[model samples]
Target: MGHKLRLLWAAYRKIVYVYLLLVLLPACALLYVYFHKASAELERQVAESMLRAVEQVRINVDYRLSIVLEVSDSLILNELLYDNLAEPASGYRFDQVMEQRNLASLIKSLKGHDILGIKLYVPDDKLYAREHVHFFGLSEARAQPWYGDVMARSGAAYWVSTRPQLYGAAGEVQALSLARLIRDPQRFERVIGIMEILVPETNYAPILSGAEFADDAEAMYILDRAGRIVSHSGASRIGERLLPQPQFAEMTSGRSGILRFAHRGEPYLAIYDTLQQNGWKTVSFVPARAISRPDWATSFASPLVLILSFLLLFILAAFLVFAYVTDGMVARLRQITSRLRLRGAETVGERIANRRGVILRLEQSVAHMLTTHEQLVADHYETRMKEREAQLRALQAQINPHFLYNALDTINWMALTRGASDISRMLNTLAQYFRLTLSKGRDLVTVEDELNLARAYLDIQQHRFDNFTFELELDPAVRECRIPKLTVQPLVENAVLHGIQRKEGHTGRLLVHAYASGAGYAIRVRDDGAGMPAEQAERLTSGLQGAPGPAPAGYGLYNVMERLRIYTHGRCRMQLDSAPDVGTTVTIFVDRLPER
Candidate 1:
């Protein structure tokens, strides 16, 4: 037996060592390399894609600005506009009508676009074609920052950061200003007036909102030279200053390129391009984690752990097999030897002389050993059953006695002051509640009995608190379903004590509802009162059972959950939903068993 056990142990150790070296080690190394390479490749792809998105946004903004510039060119060439401004006072009624018609026609051409309304600001006089023109004092037009900038530029177009509004026939609308100095036709250097285009920011949203580098990326922005957001895809970001990030210093420095930054403990990749027309930067920010592909290194960790656990278990099982086989053989051989020696077979030579007779006797010993093993297994099972039953009984006896005292005390006072009928009714309800709690020493009881237990408890509490009320809605189909006793009463007590009793002036309402759902039954208790915090509700489901309790809320809940899980073998579930000052709902779900 010793030699055979040694051989078996050696074989198992050799196999385990060989498998660890040849299989697990190499597989882990390969997975690590694959994840590293894949992560690098994914970062490269995302960076390149962000650069492309930045360029596309730049083009879209430039295109929108160019449209305004084109409109400026058309106005500069309009002979009626120049003639009307050059001369002021000498015109008839028909000439005035024609000039107004020409100005209206010019405004009509740019309609249905982002141009909210156009105003030609002239400081010369209120007399010269104020038909579509806004006449202002010369000092006033030159005093404004935007208008002064346009005047300083001579004829160059400027995209103003100040969002101005344009009032039209329809209504007033917000717009971004694109202002330019209108030049005299003959003397190109002479600035006559300013032609300002009010373009709505909505025009840029359609193009930029569709341009996304990654799902987690911040929306793209058109930032002005001062780093203020002139336009952006997300409405919330407009008018906000873009933070001067180190990653996109090129944007703030008037250069164009991409850069990476790790800011606020998060990895960021940013790309930017300068728009030549307006000196605005088209910038996009992409979070590094958003674009990273799933890595095999992370995904393979669970499987590797499972495999290691399985390997350890296999080694343990192999050792157990060796120990059991060798030990059992040695013990059996000793027993047979002792019995044979008592029959006067002491030497190996004497035993071998009657080997056929010895073999017949060995068979009888094997049969008796098998019978003994069966009996021991049966005894262990019975012992475990008795232990569980004792635990259940202990849990059942632990229901709050204060509630019983209160009910009896209320009955005694009511009997003396009120009538015999009232005394009888309250006593009957108390009897039913205790009967359901005991359930004749059985743990399982019908759903109807459970609901009645809750009803009795609530009725007794209602007499104590005048502001308290309750409703029960039980499905007829699930009335006969068997669930553990005291399930519904504890939850109802929690509702009454913590939920309704705390509210000062308002009447509190409690609801007990049960229904069939899927292949199971669900019992729900709800209350309108000052509810529990979310974390407390979460703890009731996850951490409550193991916590040391004789606690106010935890007394019955822990026991009920433990016994329910044991009886159902972990098929049932409990959930809690709550918000402060709103309400609380506790739901218990149990799988349906075969009909009794």
Candidate 2:
């Protein structure tokens, strides 16, 4: 057992070495080069896509902000509010009411589904809402920081950033506000009040969280100059400050590009663009995994899995190509080895050294050696074919057909001269037998001639032995069909010699029948005599003997089968049905019309 295991291990090691050298090493090197090149190209594409996505989001934010500016412009341009609000202490009570109505109407016209509310704080210390104006002290308005900020940036818009607009003690909502210092249209310089639009953070969520970038984007937000998130995809981060802000020095540096950073141990790519309208930055955060992902197949597979799959396919394809070539060489080598043995020679090494040795030197060299061995085997095969043909001609020369015909004719004349009826009939049958068997040396003959040959042969056999009787039932439709000569005669001969002659104490009967069955013709020879056992019957059809080496008998049957197979190219089939003490029936079926 140990010796066998060691031999197995040695063979396994040899095969593994060859496999690694021929298949695995080359495949791995190619795969490595391809994977790196593909990964680099894929990363560039992903970065470009992310940049485009971020640019698109920035464009959308700018467009929405322009709409807000348009609304602010519409308010300042209205003559009714400008006339009444610019003169703070005019005290025209009816005009103030009319101006309040006009301001309410303007806010109603500009407000959309995404708008929360609008506020107009007049320098008169009065806040004009939808219905009326609420008076407040001028000192209170001047003390507010946002009020002072709006005053400082007169004639321009300012972002108050994101903050929670508290409605009640228990209710609060995230809102993004834009405040503008409303000025008198006549002076174009005198500030009247601060006009602010408070909008829900949800209004800009669609622009920030564009569906096209959903696969990779983690977040999108508009950041104020102070690095505070004014508008974010999720309302929860609307008022949050970006901690550890990246490229803070470059944020207002008037440059726009992508930035790579890690957050909470997770890597991310930040694509940002500065908005000239508000001095704010629009940023889109994309996860590193998403940026590194290639396509559907590679994206779904882990990096390890993708590398392993590439290796597996590479090795499998290389091995398949190698094995296919190796199998062809191995088959040719086996054929050569078989031929050498038949010629009473061993392998190439044995022939050269007069001793046994392994035919293959190394796995890598085996294919080349086999190819050269095949060339030698081809020459040997040609010589053997010529010798076999010569042997066949010599065997044919020993059977002189003309001399045998003449002898049969002489015997017939003698039997007739002696007035011996039985002898004359038997001699005539023998002459017909020899004539049909020869058939002018033609291998194929009409079915009628074949049947006649069987009939004559059987007649001679029955005449020579009176223990058996025979009957012939042939279909006329198939009698003209061509068949191999002496096809039916051999079966009849077997029935007489092996079947009937073996029976005892009773007379035997032989039946020879030929008929059309479906698209083919069946020729059957049956004998009611001593039948063979199941094993012998099986061996008769299968051509397998109980032991190795040559069969002791049954050469005629096997030869007939081989000839039929070659003549029909395997289209014809033969079957044997028999049981002990019953009878034996041999049926030959030819499936196609005979050629010529």
The candidate that achieves the highest TM-score relative to the unseen native structure = 2
Q: After superposition, how far is residue 302 of candidate 2 from its true place, in Å?
A: 12
Highest lDDT: give the candidate number: 1
Residue-wise C-alpha lDDT for candidate 2, range 279-359, written one tens digit per residue: 788877667666445253442234446446656776567555555555597776787778988876534456332322121
For each of the candidates, the C-alpha root-mean-square deviation to the true structure, in angstroms, is 32.2, 44.3
Candidate 2 — which pairs collide? none
Count the clashes in each prediction. Answer: 0, 0
Please write out the lDDT profile of model 1 over residues 1-596, one tens digit for every residue: 98976787576777667867986688678657755675666566555555655765676677677667667666665566777655553437666556556666776676547566677765454343344443333445566678767877877788887464646564544467888777665567666667777788788866777776456645577777777777776766777777564434545764577667776788776678888678888877666776563333343455466556656776678578566756697886787788887876544456323111122222333454455456546654544554565556656655434446566767767776766876666676776678677675567888888898899899878767768788999999899988887788889888888877765665689999999977988999999877878777777766545763544776567766766876777778788798877888988888755264
Instruction: Give per-model TM-scores.
Output: 0.45, 0.46
Poorest lDDT segment (10 consecutive residues) of candidate 2: 355-364
Off by over 4 Å in 1: 1-30, 88-101, 128-138, 162-164, 169-172, 186-189, 245-248, 252-256, 293-596
Candidate lDDT (C-alpha), each: 0.69, 0.67
Error of 2 at 561 (Å): 98
